[model samples]
Target: MSQNSLRVVWVYPDLLSTYGDQGNVLVLERRARQRRLDVQRVDIRSDQPIPTSGDIYLIGGGEDRPQRLAAERLRRDGGLNRAVANGAIVFSVCAGYQILGHEFINDLGQREQGLGLLDVISTRGEGERCVGDVLADIDDRLGLPPLTGFENHQGITHVGPNARPFARTRIGKGNGTGDGTEGAYNDTVFGTYMHGPVMARNPHISDLLIKLALDVNALPPVDDRWYEALRNERIAAATQPS
Candidate 1:
C-alpha cells in the first residue's frame, strides 16, 4: 500500500459474508475509481493475519456461530483495533455491526466479546425476529438522504452515549429498542443493521467513507442516475403505507 492508492480491506469474508456484503467494497472501489483514485481491494480470510495499513475495512452479516468465531478471532488478531487507533475507517453491517460493539449475544445464547470499537451492545430481543425492508433517516449532520436497506436479525442493539445514532428508524424495528434509531457511529467507524449491501442502495455512505479516509472535503461526481432510481424504488417500497 502506498500513499497514492487507497487500500480497502474486506475482513473475514470467508466467515462474515452471509449477505451480499461484498458489494459494499465493490461500490467503494468503483466510486473511488470514478474519481480516478487508485484502489487496492484486499480480501482477507479468517485464517490470514489482518493488515492494519488498509485505509478502510468492511465487515458483513453472518450466522450466529460464524459471528461468534469471527469476533473471537478479531479480538485475538488485534489488527482491527490497532488500525482504528491509527484512524482507519470501518463500515460494518448486521453481525459485523454487532462485532464492532462491546458485546453481542451469540449462538450459544452466551454473551460474546466484541471489538469494543463502538459503544453499542447487542442483546437478544424477545419475540419475533426483525425482518423486511427498512427506511431510515441518516443523522441530520451527515446531510445524506434517507438510507434504504433490508433487515433480518433477532438481536436488539442499544447505542451507548459514546456513539451517535447513525440514523432514525422511520419504517422498521432497526435497533429494535423502539427509540427510532438504526445504527451507531463515532468519527471514523460506523455500524449498521441494514444489508442490501447498503452501499448499493445508498452511495452517499460509501462516498462519505472515501472522503473521510482521504481527508478530502469532496469527491469528483460520478453519474448516479441508476443509484437514484434504485434508492427511490427501495425507499418507496420500505415506507409504503401498509
Candidate 2:
C-alpha cells in the first residue's frame, strides 16, 4: 500500500445522506490513514462520468424515492457496471443495497430496476421496520466478528440463485421469518441493512473490503498489522456486549 495512493469514490445525490451513511467513508479514510495510505474521495452523479476505476465504491441507504432515483440514474449512466467490470469493490447498504440488485419493490406498489451489479432481488416492504441488533455467523475466512448493528428497512430481500447470504439476522427480520436471512455478499460486494454508520466501529469488515479491493485490483493486500489491533478490540466487544 502506498503511503499516499488509495482512491475511494462515493456515488452522489442518488446517495443516501441520511442515517450517517457518509460515516462509512470517514471510517475507511481513518483506517487507511492509520496504514499510511492516502485516501481520495469522489462523488459521481447523473451528469458526471462514473469513475472508470477506484479501490472502493460506497453507496449509502436512503428513502424509497431517492433509492429509485439513484437506481434509475445509475442504470442510465451505465458507468457503474463498467467500473465494476474494471474491478472496483462496491458496498451498498439499505436502499443502496437494493439498487445494486436486478430490482427492488418498495413499500408502495412500485417496482424499480436495480443496477444488476449484484444477483440478489428485493421484494416490496411489508410496512414493518426491522430495527434492532443484527448478528451474523460469518466463517473464519471472512475474518469478521459476530456483528451487532441496527436495521431500519421494510424491504424483504431474496437472494438470487447466484448470490450468497452474508449473514443471518438474530434480532430482526432478515430474509425470512424464524430462520431469517441477514446480509448478502458476492465477489467483493456486500449489501446489508445495518446502519448507525456501521463501518466506523466495524474496522474488521472495512479491512476485509480494503483487502478485497486490493486483491481485485491485483495490488498487494494492506498489511495485517494495522487491522489486527482493531480486529481484536472488535472481537472483545462482540463477545461482551454492553
Candidate 3:
C-alpha cells in the first residue's frame, strides 16, 4: 500500500450529510486501512472539480428535491460520466442510484434525466417505501453470500434493455417489480437503493466494489477475510429478532 494506490472520492452534490451516506466512505477507508492500503478521501461539492484519479467514487442518498438538484448539476458539469468512462469504480446508493441512470421521476410528479451512465430508469410513485432489513439471494455473478441491508426508496426501478439485476427480491423490492429490485452492476460500476451506510456494515459488497477498483488498477485481490467475517456476523444478528 502506497500513497498512490488507494485514493477514493465521495461526490457531494446535496443531501450527502443528511442521509449519512458519508458513513460508507468511512467504511471504505477503514477496510482499506485494515488491508494495509493507502487511503485518500476527496469530497466534491457543487462548485468543486471532481478529481479523475481516484480508484473509487461514492455517491450517497438524499431527498427528492436535492436528488433532482444534484442531477442537474452533474448533468451540466459532465465530470461524473467522465470518471466512470475513464474506469473509476463508482458506487451510488438510493437517490444516488437514480441520478446515475438515464432518468428519474419522483413521487411528487417530478421528472428529470440523470447522467445516463447506466441503461436503467427510476420512477418514484405510489408504492410502499420498503424499509428495514432486506435480504437478497446471491446471484452467481456476485459470487458472495446472500446480501442483506436497509432499503428506503419510493422509486421503482426498471432495468432497461442493456442492464442486469444484481439480486433477486427475497425480502424487499428487487428491480422495481413486486419481486423487488435490489441493485444493478454493469462492468465496474455498482448502483443500489440499499444503505445502512451499506458498505460500512456489509463489507462483502464492499469487497466486490474494491475488486472492481482493483481490476481498473491491475492490482491483485486483497484478502477479503474481513468481509466474510462481517457478513456472517451481520446475518446472525439479523436472524435474531429485537
Of the candidates shown, which would achieve the greatest TM-score relative to the real structure? Answer: 1
Answer with 2 or 3, whichever has the higher lDDT: 3
Each model's lDDT: 0.93, 0.73, 0.75
Worst 10-residue lDDT window for candidate 1 reads 1-10
Per-residue error for 144 in candidate 2, Å, reads: 1.2
CA lDDT of 185 in candidate 3?
71
Give candidate 3's error at residue 212 in angstroms. Answer: 1.9
Candidate 3 colliding pairs, count: 7
The candidate that achieves the highest lDDT relative to the unseen native structure: 1
Show pairs that collide, candidate 1: none
Which scores greater on TM-score, model 2 or model 3? 3
Order by lDDT, highest first? 1, 3, 2
lDDT of 1 by residue, 107-203 (tens): 9999999999999999999999999999999999898999999999988999999999999988998999999999999999999999998999999
Give residue 133's error in model 3 in angstroms: 1.3
**lDDT-best of 1 and 3:** 1
